[model samples]
Target: MRRTPHCRRAHQEHLGKGTPLSVIICDIDHFKQVNDRHGHLSGDRVIQEVAGLIARQLRAGDPAIRWGGEEFLVVVQASSGVAMGLAERLRSAVEHFHDPEVGQVTLSLGVAEILSGESIEQLLGRADGALYRAKRSGRNCTISAAGN
Candidate 1:
């Protein structure tokens, strides 16, 4: 893909009009342990399953990218509250998803609404930081960039 997404400019236009767009950063909790305890094959399956779950649940046209090994980033044309609600759904889905080989895998997510005049990088960083908070607070939960 390109350095930035084409929809980002669209997001900027909405931001220009004072509309909020939210980003959600998701990571598989204790992914390394999964790989160590099971195997790379199982770990890969876990990532693939989680990624598919997230991708399938988001808005049809929204961008759901594999941000890293076990991480996914989603950008949606919605408010922080809306995105947070979506994240919780994804977290719950992952929680209840039972992989025969990988067992149960949980997701921790961070959500951030684009601030006025904020760049895409800044928005994503804030979202990622919020995800880190969720990871720290334990796992299998969602956290918003605002306040906490």
Candidate 2:
């Protein structure tokens, strides 16, 4: 699937006025295992259910996109601290989410705020890197970009 231009547009929309722009990269933890243990249909249901949970958690008008097969990207107008807080809340929401077929599902999230003059791709890269760290440290957790 093609990636959306939400971040770039948000960057352009907020650049000159000093708006705080943040991004969160969220991935379902051990999703492949879920597919293997359950089934593809079950996996799809898990995705849908998790997406609903995430959508309900976000503030109205926040953009949450399916960045990959089992990953989501959320764009927010908030500081790094606020983004981290949002990430934690999203994590907790996913942790507690239960599906009749899938039981419980968890998420690993990474958050990064835009740096001065940084491209949207760079900000997303940082968030993705933080997500990798969260996955490595252990799933079902949130990580902020290092030294942000």
**Runs off by more than 4 Å, candidate 1:** 1-3, 15-19
**Model 2 stretches astray by more than 4 angstroms:** 1-3
**RMSD from true fold, candidate 1:** 2.2
Clash count in backbone of candidate 1: 0
Candidate that would win on TM-score: 2
* Candidate with best lDDT: 2
Q: Candidate 2 at residue 129, lDDT?
A: 93
- Encode model 2's per-residue lDDT on 6-119: one tens digit a residue: 776778777867888999999999999999999999999899998999999898767799888999999998899999998898999988878987788999999999888788
TM-score on alpha carbons, each prediction: 0.90, 0.95
